[model samples]
Target: MPRGSALSQSLIDTAHALADAARAETLAHFRNPGLDAANKAAAGFDPVTEGDRAAEAAMRAILAERRPGDGVFGEEYGITRGSSGLTWVLDPIDGTRGFLSGTPTWGVLIAACEGTRPVYGIIDQPFIGERFEGGLGVARYRGPQGEAPLRSRQGVALKDAILFSTFPEIGTAQEAARFREVSARARLTRFGMDCYAYGLLALGHVDLVIEAGLQRYDIAGPIAVIEAAGGIVTDWQGGPADEGGRILAAGSPELHAEALALLSGTAAEGAA
Candidate 1:
């Protein structure tokens, strides 16, 4: 719905509540020596820790009490259909692997999505005590340095851009080759920041983040936050990215276009 509306405000409030609940639950198991994960993937090591489940359950409990009519699509619990025409997309810990490794980059991602589009979102890092919220006329960061408005960097050329991806060997072989093509021209390319990378992008500390083989919950919160901070987020084909798949987020439209062209293998000669 529209920003500042009663429903909008309520949704924003509920998102924060969810984040708060997740922070408490996730931190309880964050660095515990007994922390163990179950392989969720059939072929590979897709781990899910106790912290992930506990956090999602806590968030779901709050939603059941506050926004009972809203649907939920969570990484741990799957989907819970509701009648409110909205869905709470939750990834209790966006980087379970890193969380298992005791890195502070793991985060709780919560987005109040209307249909497939996120209307408000929060990326909360419990260990760092940092929260980045966007959408619904709110784009700000709260961290040790204090609160600040979030504005993505503008006018950075492709060659000067700082690029980030969660994994160096992104997606399939074709996708990895495409990613390398863009990385070759960027000023710097780093990996494995997870959702924290998106937070940095919205804060204007980073310029671009590209990833593939993502689910809706993986990118929904980041999409709302980054776009609210004057950034552009789309698929490699330049389509709406909230549905996931391949995502390309850049601090500015010009930079996004350059990166998109390269990712799609459509840039003209010398465009990079």
Candidate 2:
């Protein structure tokens, strides 16, 4: 869609509305002592709480009412096909672990996608009263201090960059080794920020976020936001990361190339 077209505005408005509705549902269960979780994983612990369900349901309700022709794909509910060819991809609470731990790093991810590509997206942290938006000619951050343009830090070298990832283990043992190759060279490396790390990348506070074993919802929103902020997000092979596996996000192409070389074991002696 054209950046400032009527459809673009309408979709943007609906995205904010969906975020608002999700905020209420998620906040209601955020730190509730009575809140409990169910394990979605069989081998280890992958938790899903009422907050995830309720928040997604609330957003779906708004989509069904206002954008009935658009499709919906959410973490909790799977997919609901529509004729418009645009899907609203949602991860009601991107970090269930963080939410369960009562940390503010968990966020609600909302993205309007055309096929596999996100055209507009929002990363919202309800507890922090912050929202990062991008795509459709929009790249902005709105929070307690007020709204501001979102711009990724430019010309950062990998050795001087700060990096983030949700888990120290990353994907598999080999993937973890690849991650360590990059982390070993970074000026600073932090873990466990979930989607909020992407928000920080958009705000230029961080330079890179690498992860693996993600779903479409895990990355679509962040991809839109970070790309809008003039950053780059792709798989380790420098391919599309929208479908979600082994993502490498960097604030600048220089950083991206340097990190990509390390991740892929293709770095020259003095590359980047």
Candidate 3:
């Protein structure tokens, strides 16, 4: 918005609009047996339902109408021809497996990026009527209870913290092995959370969020929201987690490094 004015409220509006559109379109497919789920990547592989495709298409359409020049790269649909610096990364449905199973853990993820770096993000859980959005300076939470500022939990060590993730099913072979090492080092691990799992981690209910086989859209929204909420997020290799590799986010820098070392097999029992 306004060419790089990330803090400007106008920028926030676009993010919110896209979030609203994607969330509505995604929920429209819930509980509808008639909806089609097709293999989008490899054969018998990652599924893409009408929900995902329509949600992304809806977001793209809104961008076309409101921010005519902004580029959009989505999970279901490919990139649309538009601007580069002003971009929107979207995961129309994060927990598609859960969605297909009639679970409500799925949600719509969106983030605004400038020059390949995120400036703002919004994760909308339409079924639960909740939204996590923020960027420039700070982040805020709005839900059925109304709006409030959110902060990460303070000063927790790995042994005392709770960890959340997608588990081995969502990871590649190499990533899965690395994840086992990390799990052994964590206090505890829980499975079957998509993007919502990361939101819970950022909100301080959980301490660490480690996910693998994630696409750009999968991590972009969570990265912006969590970082804005004062948590640290990065790739598994201890580098920037801009959809570069896998993702690991922790409540603090200490935990972030410790988790990275555990996954990397270089740590000596929380030595990081």
The number of the candidate with the highest lDDT is 2
Give stretches of model 3 more than 4 Å off: 1-7, 170-174, 268-272
lDDT of 3 by residue, 33-103 (tens): 88667776665667779888888888888888878887888887778757536878888998888777778
Task: Report the error of model 1 at residue 106, Å.
Answer: 0.8
CA RMSD for every model?
1.5, 1.7, 2.5
Residues 3-50 of candidate 1: C-alpha lDDT, one tens digit per residue: 567877788888988998999999999899999999999998999998
- In order of appearance, the predictions have TM-scores of 0.97, 0.97, 0.91
lDDT of 2 by residue, 1-272 (tens): 34458889899999999999999999999999999999999789999999999999999999999999989999999999998889999999999999999999999999999988999999999999999999888999999999999999998888899999999988999999989999999999999999999999999999999999999999999999999999999999999998998899999998999899989878844564
Could you give me the TM-score of model 1 versus the true structure?
Answer: 0.97
Error of 3 at 107 (Å): 1.2
Clash pairs, candidate 1, are: none
Q: What's the lDDT of the predicted structure labeled candidate 3?
A: 0.79
Off by over 4 Å in 2: 1-4, 268-272
Cα deviation at 188, candidate 1, in Å, is 0.4
